[model samples]
Target chain A: MNPLLEIRNLSFSYEGSKSLVFEALDLSVREGEFLLVKGPSGSGKSTLLRLICRLNPPLGGTILFQGSDITAIAPARLRRSLCYVAQIPQMIDASVEENLLLPFSFAANSSKSPPSREELRAMLRKFYLEEVEPAQSAMKLSVGQKQRLAIMRALLQDPLLLLLDEPTSALDQESAAMVFSIMERLNIEEGKTLITVTHADYKPVKKRPLNYMLDNRRLNLLP
Target chain B: MNRIIDISLAQLFLALLFILIAQISSFIYHLGLNRDITIGTIRTFAQLFLMGYVLTFILKSSNLWLVLLVFFVMVLSAMFIVKGRVREKQIPYFIPTFLTMLISYFATALFVSGVIVGTAPWWDPRYFLPAGGMVIGNSMSALAIALERLFRDLREQRELVEMKLALGANYREASDELFRKAVSAGMIPSINAMMGVGLVFIPGMMSGQILAGTDPLIAIRYQIVVMLMLVGSTAVTSVVVMLIVRRRCFGSGEEVLLR
Candidate 1:
């Protein structure tokens, strides 16, 4: 089967910087695969994710998502199937219900049926969230709750792929473990693809997942 | 409707009572009986009373030039308010604001008075003055908020926008999120004021006309027209100013000076 995503000869650099961040870098991920990308600071791990998500145009490279070049795709349509959760997700200053329903309100998701209250409750509970107060404001939520809320929001769209940047960076060990377990379950049960960029030891969840390390301007498959 | 007394003295007392309450509340907030409070109160009374007498004369005489002069002065003051409120003083702001006010207010005022209402002179003080004030008021607020929001969003979200462009979103799409947010914030006040007008306070225009002994029905019709004009001018001014400023803020290569 064709890979779900493929990055070919990706090269990028800051506008005025002489040192190129990456050159001739290639990477691919299959459908339903959970790819944990590990890299030290300043190794362009985030940049690779940005390129795949088309958040930043690559200086010289082509990114193929489902056989179509991402650069050539309409943004809202492309982003509809691919949600990127920043390291620090900025939840809008609205009620939790509104924030969760935001993606549904976007023109891209307008046709999709809204998740019923029962489905929302189930999803929240699946992520260990128990509250269902529609008026509970997002600003009052903790960072871990916000992150989980964001994940639940992405999941609501039934996105084909989720690009999470440091999803567990702000959570406690228990919360992080819960997040990993949730991701693991989604990978196995729902066949959802996840590309998570982190500096943490993802080895704990790599037992049944593909792992790669971005080092010295190259992405290499890790043993 | 008959729950209240209908005497003219009673109505005058009621109006005076409300005004007195407003002044006293303001004084209380500023610490009543202080020299600053006393001076402000005197100035407020003097200005309004003087304007009330002057406007009576202006309305009766219907001098077109005098009305135009007042409109011009109001627009100039609005421009200064916009400049003072915005943090970035380096921008040659007078141009955009003046242009925005002129276009938005004149277009709406001329259309409402000349084409719609069919004012004989079209520049009659009775029609032009109030219409001009309403349009200028709305555009003033809209321009101030829109410019501030655009500049602020560019400053704060420069990186996010850059990230979007890097993501292959064009400058328009990359800044699209911020653009929507800025426009929304700019219009929220006007929208809310509109929604809560009668409930929160009888809007100044309608109240002024009612107090001046016009039929309440006529006052309400004018108020309704003023509200529509305000909303229209605000929406137009906001979108236009943003479109104009967006060009200056970003380069052809989709590069933006966010900072």
Candidate 2:
């Protein structure tokens, strides 16, 4: 079976920096697979996530998504299929519902109707957030709630691949478990692909999942 | 019509005496502006004197080309000044900046000269050059404000823009909100001036006309027309600049071009 995303000889370095984060690295992610990448700080774990989603363009080599070069795909089309949730989540100044509905307001997602109120409530409930109202201001939410809201917002786009950076770093054990369960449902039942970069411990909800570590600018599978 | 009185050379020198008083006070107070004040006073004298001759020659010539050449020079100088004011030389600002200024100022100048003023030979230097100068000069200042705000916002709100892009937004949708804020800030000064005109302040154009022995009512009418022209030109130029800058802020790949 063909991989959903293929990275060949990828290399990257930030501007004005002498050190290279990675060079001549290769990676592949299968369709509907859940990938958990673990690495200590400054291992380029977050940078790798950014490179996959095209937020930070790769300095060298090519990233192929679904058998097509990402460079050749229209950016709007590419982003709609691959969404990235940053380590420090970004939120709009409006109500939580408005923030969630923002994707549909964009012309790129104009054809995708926004989730209904009941559907949104159900999604919120899945992450153990049962009381977050649509009209409640998003700016006033706690860091944990905001992180879940960002995940929910990413889900609203109905993307084929979800790239999350430190998805559970901001949550406690219980909340982290609930969020992981939601990710499990999305991967197993809904057949969505997920690539999460985090240093936190997670129990697999399905049969043995793949785990990898980035060291010295190379991705190596962990036993 | 009452004949306007011209100040004698002594009276003009009297004006310099006040500037001398300012220079001496600056020296007494240990103010660092002593050099700037002296240089500014000298440059003002030299520039106005040169402009007086240049204006006289341009008006005397009936050739439309000569008049347009002078107008073009004025617009170019204004755009260059704005570029320095914004302090953003890295961005390819010259093309969009110059194009917006030229189109806005010249279009307004033509409408005023051709339709409203109905001057014979619509490109008549006497009527169009001064009007073009005032309109283009004000538009330049307004555009500087908009461009400066845009540069700051693009840096500060980069995360928000990237989030929007990740949410399946096109560049235009992501930048639409900032565009409104920047353009409004640019147009606020002209709007405030319009609101206070005749009530809290008398504008320079009207004052100049009145001092030149024109009837106060006619001067007020001209001032109204000129103010409207300035407001329209500023609005158009500011909008155009923001549109172009917004597009450039995004890369060819539809990602936010974070510098």
Candidate 3:
């Protein structure tokens, strides 16, 4: 199958910084592929996801999403298709149900109908947040719950790819395990494409994921 | 209309007695405001006298170009004041903010003087200058507050805004809350003033007119127009400035660019 996303000779550096964060880095993710990138802290792991989402402009090279230059596509459209979940989940000052329904509020997503309450409740259950009341304030959720909720919200958009930054970095071991299980389910059962960047030594029990090490501004496949 | 009584220089000098009381309190309380009081007094006399002479010349000449030139100068000064107040180094907002102020102030002043007041020449120095000056001056402070709040809030809430963007919200949708807040910050003072206008105290313009021996009823009418004019100008100026500055906060990729 043709790659769903491709990166060619990507290079980026922060403004006024002498050193490059990523130099001539290359990556390709095919449909329904689960890829894990492990790196030390500040290894530009988060930057990689951001660059794919076009949150930060790449100084050189190109990002192709579905064989089209991401820059050529409208940013909101690109972002909606390749949704990102930040390391620390951010929730609006509203109910959990409202936060879940936030993406449909955008003009780009206006054509998509919001999930019904029954559907939303099922999603919350599938994400291991079955106890979370829809009407409860999203801000009151624990860090782990928020992360799961963030992933669930992204899924509601029905994105082709999910870019997760440190999906389990802030969770306890049990919570981390729960998140990993969810990731496995998303990839194996739902056949959803995922690119997860983490600094942890995590390996999914049920499926073998293509692993890469990001270090010294290079992404190398780990045999 | 009654004939106005003019105060002689000697009688005006007696007004210094009030300054003397303030100075005495400052000295006794060790407030160290004596220097500020002295400079303020000097500036009050020099600036007001200079403005009086300049107004005399402009009114006597009645040249439309000259009146417009004065209005431009006022707007330029107001822009710099706003620039000094909003301390954002990342975004180059000075030119856009200045242009917003110029357009909004000019349009609002023209409407008030030509359409409402029905000044014969429309650029009549007597009505246009003061009307434009008030619009620029009040909106200047409001713009500063709005810009300050906007840049500060954008920096503080960078993650929140980016979260919205990541969820496919456009720049406008992402920063909608911040935009509303900045506009509100700019408008609250004027709204509060409106609430307190006639009941809390006679406004400065109305008081000045009454002191100039204009009939109280007529003075009240002018004051009402001035008050409403300020509200309209402040709202328009703040909204326009915020709209322009909001675009500067984002990049071509629709990302939050605040450092």
Candidate 4:
């Protein structure tokens, strides 16, 4: 079977530097695979993810998704299918509901609209985010709450690929477990592909996930 | 009480009317600031009263030097406002504002008085001073918006702007969205005035001319000229300010101004 996502001969360097971070690196993920990437700080792990989302471009090499070059794809369409959840989410100055609905405002997702009111409440209830006060400002939410809100925003897009960069970094242990459990359910139960980069060796409740580590400017299997 | 000079009730009441107009302007923003209202009223009374007495003395003496001095004072005060508000350590904030205001308002006022209204001396107190004040006031506001936005855009979006450059967007394309936002913000108040004129409220210049016993038709014609000048001056000043400021804002490479 064809890989769901593929990176071939990817090489990059910061501007004004005669060094390569990931030289001639190749990786592939199958459908519904849970890949956890481990790396030390500044190992180009974050840069690799950013390049996958097209936030930054690789100096050389192509990133292909579903047999097509993602770099050549239109930005709006690529962003719709492949959502990048940043380590620190940037919320526009708006309400919680408004932020959740922001992705729908894009032309590609507008047809999806939003789930019905009941569906929205049900979805929020799963994450314990009850809509008790719709008019309250989103800035008032705690960091953990904002992170969850960012995840909800990504889920709202109905994206085929999820690139989560340290989603559980700021959460307490309990919150981290809840988030990981939800991610596992999405991967195994719902059959969505998830590529998460984390420092921890987290074991999912549903599916046993594959692991990779970034060391010596190369991605290698952990096991 | 040297400050307590003879003033008629009708003059005081007309002054109070303008004060009230300024006071009620906060309704649009829901900023029901009664203190702001009272302070604004007192300020308007003091300023207009001083100008009235000072100009009366100048008109009676008909001294050209005194009138020029008053114009100089206005320009200096305008420079102070721009410098304080912009507060840029790198650029001389006052120079851009002074040059912009002088070129825009002075040129328009000269054209209006010399060619159109045909006032005697072309710098007549009855014509040139008030016209210059109106044009300069609007230009100062537009410059404030443009300068504030240029500095803020540099500070806030350093990463995303750099990302745009990586994505094959040129310097022009990378900055175009931000430049458009800044220009739109600079143009908003004037656009609102255009939309609301003769519907929600009459502008101050037309009202003042009408109250001064000029024909309403002539007042409105002059008001139209002033409004058009305001739009022209705002557009010209913002573009010019952005062009001059953009040089200092960008570095040699993809690096942007941050700090």
Q: By lDDT, who's the top model here?
A: 3
lDDT winner, 1 or 3: 3
Candidates sorted on lDDT, descending: 3, 2, 1, 4
Residue A179 in candidate 1 has what lDDT? Answer: 82
TM-score of chain B of each: 0.77, 0.93, 0.92, 0.78
| Order of quality (TM-score) | 3, 2, 1, 4
Per-residue C-alpha lDDT of model 3 across residues A120-201, encoded as one tens digit per residue: 9999999999999999999999999999999999999999999999999999999999999999999999999999998777
TM-score of each: 0.62, 0.92, 0.96, 0.59
DockQ of each: 0.06, 0.70, 0.83, 0.04
Residue B136 displacement in candidate 1 (angstroms): 6.9
Residue range B113-145, candidate 3, lDDT tens digits: 899999998988888888998888888999999
Q: Using TM-score as the measure, name the better of candidate 2 and candidate 3.
A: 3
Query: Could you tell me the lDDT of residue B221 within candidate 1?
Result: 86
Chain A of candidate 4 gets a TM-score of 0.94
Which 10 successive residues of model 3 chain A have the least lDDT summed?
Answer: A199-208
Which portions of model 2 show Cα errors greater than 4 Å? A16-19, A172-177, A205-208, B16-38
In model 2 chain A, which range of ten residues has the least summed lDDT? A201-210
Provide the lowest-lDDT 10-residue window in model 2 chain B.
B250-259
All candidates' lDDT scores?
0.76, 0.86, 0.93, 0.74
Q: Kindly list the per-residue Cα lDDT of model 1 for residues A1-223, writing each as its tens digit.
A: 9998888998898666878888888988889989889888988888777666665666898888999997677766777777777777666678878877777765566788887777777778888888646578988888888888877787778878888888999989887888888888888889899999987665455346778888878799988
- Candidate with top TM-score is 3
